[model samples]
Target: MGKRVLITGSNRGIGKKLVEQFAQNGFNIVACARKKDDSFDDYLKDIVRMYNIDVTTSYFDMEDEQCIKRELKSVINKVKTVDVLINNAGYGQNALFPMISSNELKKEMQINYISPIIISQIVSRVMIRNGGGSIINIASVSGIRNEQGRLAYGSSKAALIFATKTMSLELAPNNVRVNSVSPGFIDTDMWNNRSEQIYKKVLSETPLGRQGNTKDVADLVYYLASDAASYITGQNIVVDGGRMI
Candidate 1:
């Protein structure tokens, strides 16, 4: 059997691709997402067939604190001693600063930053008991820099980056390594829905001359989860194709 890993928001986008990649590499996957209907059952079944790995699905809504606590407590044993935990459930904030409400900002923080922190606390205890584990936080390039209309989204990821570094220091003594993967504009559903003007602007500034695909992020995540990254922690690796330059 391979190492067990729990990844949130694995129903679609980069998160979904991560699940597939890890499972193919023989890792047991605990893939969580919001409650799904029958329509999505086929998706999970397809992945199960393709990977030949155990993929456990759980209902998690980050906006609800009670849901997070309850879900984590119930599955604590399954995730306890797990090899890795990927925090990947976040959204984009497209509203301008003046138009964005305080409530919206708070919700963004709740989903993008606060929930991941809470989940990590629960999982890290399990890792400690099991001797050690790895944690890979899925952050964004926006976290490291500023954006015009991404006040809430960017700030939430920024908070996550800080939490990742601090937790790495706190968990290092216990042998648990924590790191982050900050991706550039990836080809996901969100990117597909981005306005043409916004997309063009992003592409123009990106040094790679093209946007990234979900596999690009997933591949990097797989590498970080391996033993090759054992000595690396408290670092935010930017997978932006030199976009920041």
Candidate 2:
């Protein structure tokens, strides 16, 4: 049997890519989403048949703390060990700072930052008990950059980035590793919803002059989960096409 990996937001985009990447590489999967998705279910079915690996589906709202714990606990009870956990479910907001409400900020923090930390805590303990594993938090470059119309989303990712560092430090002794992958403009479902003006603006600013795809992020994540990156931890590796530079 291959090592098992648990991933959140596996219904589409980068989450789906991450699931497929690991599946292709022969990993048992615990794929989670906010709700059930038929297309994604079919995709997983194909992966299971192709790889001959175990694949489990978990559903929970990131805002529901108890449900998150309960669902993960059940998966853990069955699999006993998850070699990797990816916190890949998050949303970006485009509201201006002045227009952003406290409720909106709180909501972003809850789902993007706090929930990932909670999930990490639960899974890391399991990793510790199971002889350790790896964790990757899918953050955004907006966390490190002070861009307009991203106050809530940016701040939430910033908190998550910092949490990844702290968690890595504490968990290192237990043979677990934690890192953050900060992606720039990726051509995903989130990108499709944004305005064309924003797209052009980002493209002009990016040194590569093209938007990154989900595979770009997934490839990096796959390496971090492997033994090749065992010496790495607590780093916020950017996939931004030199936008920050």
Candidate 3:
């Protein structure tokens, strides 16, 4: 009986945490991922058993346009309406521009920027039919500030931020709201995978003196997707633990 939400890349990290938070709030979740395994299966089983919320999993590959189309089709066919859509499937790349390969740059953009666009377009149709919905895009602080080695990732997030703003305007007439959550120095696998030197440097600069946790981002995202944010749209909220300032 809860509102249905379709969250991309929900198998791990911030996306996974978001799934848990939303489920706690009594939301029916369509947790989409690029693949499936025991870990995610167990996670979903536990969430469903514990929260008693309706939960389904879908397979999605952002880089493959065909895969995006197929997954969207399957979701729409399965769920009559998607009350909330979270564009959170993206990748991060850090390296000097000259040192980064063109293919790598393209892959970053495809996952971080293009993939969201495709998913939004497909999902927005379902929202349009549902009369209204909320779109929460997971962006990054790099979207607002330039960093030493985040050339590709930063640029892609910047585009996503812009997309959230513009999509809000276009979807508002149909009663849909679009917004973004930009987190800085989140303590997710993305950060853990970075070199120790880079991580240390980032931590040294953060005013909070620590990295953020996935739950931090998940909480904010869940709030934005709720009825409490009914009047909010076209905004990029920075949840960076004051790292930007």
Candidate 4:
């Protein structure tokens, strides 16, 4: 049996890519995503066949705290000890402050901030008992920079990043490392939906002159979860192609 990793939002985009990279690297994966029907099941089957690695799936609604707890409990029961946890399940709704609703704000906070913290708390207990583990929170460049339509989305990510720093301090003594990765303009479903003008502006500002691919983020995450980053913790590493500069 290989080391185990639990990744949330593993059915698509960056999460899906993370699963592939980790599976290729010989990690047994406990992939979590919303139950979207038979297609997701087929995809999981393909992933297991392609990587020849142990793969399991759990369905959960991040907006529902009870569902998150129940689903995570199921994973914990099956894996017993998870070596890595990647909090990659999140969505951004583009709306200016005036257009944003209270419901939207709450949902964003729940999914992007509160849910990850809860998942981390539960997984950290197992990690502590097992002597150590890594927790990586997928933050965003929008969290670091103020954007017009990211009132709720950006605030939620910023909170997650802060939570990562706090978790790192408390979990370090237990050998549980906590860190965050803030990606710039990644060409995922999230970016694909943006307007052409938004895309053009982002590319023009990005030193790389292009959006990053899923593998770009996945590779950095793999490194953080490996023994190579043993001494690293509580840091938010940005992978934005120098866009912040």
What do the candidate models score in CA lDDT, each in turn?
Answer: 0.87, 0.93, 0.90, 0.93
Weakest 10 consecutive residues of candidate 4 by summed lDDT = 34-43
**TM-score computed on alpha carbons, candidate 4:** 0.98
Q: Which residue pairs collide in model 4, if any?
A: none
Cα error, candidate 3, residue 178 (Å):
0.5
| Candidate 4 Cα errors over 4 Å, as ranges | none
User: What's the TM-score of each model vs. the native?
Assistant: 0.95, 0.98, 0.96, 0.98
* Candidate 2 global CA lDDT score: 0.93
Candidate 1 Cα errors over 4 Å, as ranges: 78-80
How many times do residue backbones clash in model 1?
0
lDDT of 3 by residue, 145-193 (tens): 9888899999999999999999999999999999999988888888889
Candidate 3 at 213: error in angstroms?
Answer: 0.8
| Residue range 73-153, candidate 1, lDDT tens digits | 887756455789999998776899889999989999999999999999988888898889999999998898888888999
RMSD of each: 1.4, 0.9, 1.3, 0.9
Per-residue lDDT of candidate 4, residues 1-245 (tens digit): 78999999998899999999999999999999877668877877887898888888889999888988988888789879899999999988999888899999999999999999999999999999999999999999889999999999999999999999999999999999999999989979999888999899999999988789999999999999999999999999999888998
